[model samples]
Target: MPNLPDPLPWPEAVAPDTTAFARQAILNLNRTIFGFELFDRSLAQGTHTSASDAALLFNVLSHAECEVLMQRKIIFINCTHDTLASGHLELVPPERVVLELPPLDAPQRDDVETHLMALTDIRRRGFRLAFDQSVLTEPHLSWRPLASFIKIDISHASESELSAWVQMARQNPKARLIAEKVETEAQFAMAQDLGFTLFQGYWFAKPILLSGKTVRPAQAAIIQLINLVRQQASTAQIEDVLKRDPTLSFNLLRFINSAGFGLKHEITSFRHAVMMLGLKKLFRWAALLLTTSQGAGTSPAVANLAVVRGRLMELLAADSLTPEECDNAFVVGVFSMLDTLLGMPLAQAIEAIALPDTVVDALLHKQGLLAPYLELTVACENADDAMFAKASATLKLSSQQVNWAHLQALSWTETLVD
Candidate 1:
C-alpha cells in the first residue's frame, strides 16, 4: 500500500460542512457489476481541487478492511492533476483502480503539456487512466492514448455526436467505452448498439412493475422468519418456520458460518444457529435474507445498496436515537428499496412484512422521527449537494462522521458474500 503524504495539505477549516462519497456502478455490457466510480456528492461543479481529491482518496485507502473488498473489483476514482501527482496515488494498486482524469476547464497549451506528462508518469507506474468525452476534442488528443476507459455521458450528447465520440474513442485500441448516465431502456439499447462495452447510471435500478406481481413464496418465508424472530418467538417455533423452508434454513446456516460472523465452528442445525445468534442478531440476519431472496428481475446491486443504506442509517443514528429507534432506522434503510426489489409499489411491497410505525412511516411516507436519518442515508447515495447538506444540518452530524460511517457501511456489506 502507498503511504499518504506526511502532512496532508487539505486544511481542516476550509472543508465543507458535509463531505460524503457515493459510488455509481460501472457495469459491463451484460449489466453485471464491473467496478464503481467513487465521487463526492457535496462537491459543487468546477470545485474539485487538490484538497477535495486527496480527501476522497484518503477516505478510501485509509480503511484496512475495505482493502479486501476493493481488491475484488476495479475501482474508478476521479482525479485532478494534483491528485495524480500526489503520493497517495502511489499507495493504490494500479491494476485494481482506474484514475479518471477530467479535462481542463480552460485548456492552455503549456498547461495541457504539463498535464500530459503527469498522465504519462502515472500510467508508466502501472495505473490505468479514464477520460470523459471531452477527450474527443482536438486539444485533448495528446492524452487519449493513455486512456484505459472512455466515459461518454449519454445524457449530454445526441446520437450522431455520441457516435462520433465512440468512433474517436475506438482509435485507442486499449480503451473500453462507457455510457454514462443511462437512465432508460432506450439509452441502454442505443449505447449497446453504439458498441459501448460498459455502462453506468440509474437505468438498472429502476423498477419494472407488473400489474399482478407480488412477493415470491421464498421471500415471504424469509419475511415470516424475520417477523417470528422480531417477536422473540420460542426456539421451537423459530425452528419450525425454518424446517418448513429448507432453503431459508440453509441460508441461515450458511450466513452464520460466513466470514462476517467469524464463527470458529459450523452449527448444522437451525435451532443451534438460532440459539447462537439470539433474537436481535437473528432478526437482522433474516431481514437481509428477505432482500437477497432470489426474486426475478431484481439487480444484485440493488440488494447490496439496500444493505449499505441500512447499515449507514443505523450507524448515523447510533449516538442520538434510542436503541429501538436506531434499530428502526436500520429497517428503514434496508426496506427503502422494497418496491424495486419486489417489482411493485413500495406501499404494496411493504404490506407483506410487519414493521414498527417508525420504519413504515419512513419507508412509505418518508415521515416520522427516523425520516431524517433515511434522508441522510439516501443523500449519501445521491449527487444532490443541497440534500446532503440539509440532511446533515437537520441531524447536526458533521462531514467527518457521515463520511466515516458511509465507508464503514460499505466495508460491512462487502463482508456478506452470497
Candidate 2:
C-alpha cells in the first residue's frame, strides 16, 4: 500500500464533534464494555496526520480520563514503530495506557525486537503494552514478555488458529487476552470459551429505528403511500390508500400535528396532513423515514457507523460528481447494510421503497461507481488490507483520500448518531 500523505491542512476548525468517535467505539464493542479505548486524532498538527501522533494523543488523554474514572484498567491505543522510536511513552503515564503495537507490513525481526525493548522500558515505568491484530503466529510471540495483553483478530482465525490462541492464552496466565471483531453470538461464545476477557463488535446492539417493530408495518405503508403520491395520483386516490390503513393514517396525522411539522391547527386526518405537506415534502419525509426507521434500535455506535460511512463517501465524491450523484452515493453507504441491521434480506427491506437509480443499483447489485466506494467502506470496517487496496485502486482514489474518508466517516457517524 502507498503511504498516505501527511495530514492535509486541518480545516479552519476541527469540528468539536467527538460523538462519532464515541459511537464507533460503542459499535465496535457492541455492548457497553467498560474501558472504551479510542484512537484520538486531535494532536496531528499542521499537514501531517501521523498515525504515531494519533496513538500518542490517545494514550495521554484516554489514560488520564480512565484513571479519573477510577478504572485502573488499561485502555488500548494503537502505536506505530515511528511513534515508539520518538519516545512518546516518556510523556505518557504508563500504568493506564495499553500501547497496542499495530501489525507491521514487512515483519522485520530486528525492528520488532527494538520496538518491544522500548515497550518493555515503558512497561517497567508502569505502562502496559499489547499486540494488536495478531496475524503472525508463533513468531510474533517472541515479544510477549513486553506485552500485558494480546488482541487476536478472531474474525479471520481458523479452528487451528483459534485453538492456538486459546492455548497461548491459557499458558500465559499473566496476560489478558482480547478478541477483536466478535460480531456474532457465536464469535462471542467462542471467545469466552477460549478464555478471552475483552470483546468488541456489533452483536450486542443492532442498528434499528427508534420505533423498532412498531414502525415496521407503518413504514411499509408509508413507502407505498409515498410511491403513489410521487406518481402524481389524485388526492382522492392517495386518500383511498390512506383509508385502507387506518393505523398509518392516524400515525401520519399524529406526526404532522407533533412538533415535527410546526402546524398550528391539529391535522384531524391523514388526508389533511397529506394535502398540507404536499407531494414534495411528503416525499422528503418518506425518504427520511427510510433512514430514521433503520436507525431506531441501534446503539449510538452502530448508528454512527452508518452515518460516517454515508457522509465520508459523499464528501469524497463531492468534487467529482453532481449533487444528485453525491446524494445517491450517500444513500448507498447509509443503506448498504440495512438487511443485516433489520434482520431481513436487503432486497426484502428495500422492496417497497423507491430509491434513486444509482442507489438501487449499488444496493441491489453492488455495481456502478458508488458500489466501489461502498465496498471500500466495508473493507475499512473489516480492516482488510487487500480488499481496501483493491477498492482504492478500482476507484482510482489515493491512499490519503481513503484514510481521510475513513476518518471523516468515523467522525461523522459519531456526531450524527449522538
TM-score of each prediction: 0.85, 0.60
* Residue pairs with backbone atoms closer than 3 Å in model 1 (clashes): 2-91
Please provide, for model 1 over 1-418, each residue's C-alpha lDDT reduced to its tens digit, 9 standing for 90 to 100. 0111121222353345445587777788656689988877656664887777766666566556458546677888887788877676766567777888878877365588788988999899998999988887878899989999999999867899999889888999889999998887689889999999999887665444445786787888888887887677899999999999888888778777776566678789888999988898788777877776636755688788888888889888888889888888888888888777877787788786778988988887878899999888877776556778889999998767777677677777876767
**Candidate 1 wrong stretches, greater than 4 Å:** 1-20, 41-46, 85-91, 106-114, 156-161, 204-211, 230-237, 257-268
lDDT of each prediction vs. the true structure?
0.78, 0.59
lDDT accuracy of residue 316 in candidate 1: 89
Q: 52 in model 2: Cα distance from truth in Å?
A: 5.6
lDDT of 1: 0.78
What lDDT score is found at residue 378 in candidate 1? 76
Collision count of model 2: 17
Candidate 2 lDDT by residue in tens digits, 8-56:
3434333343211221241223444344554443322222233445543
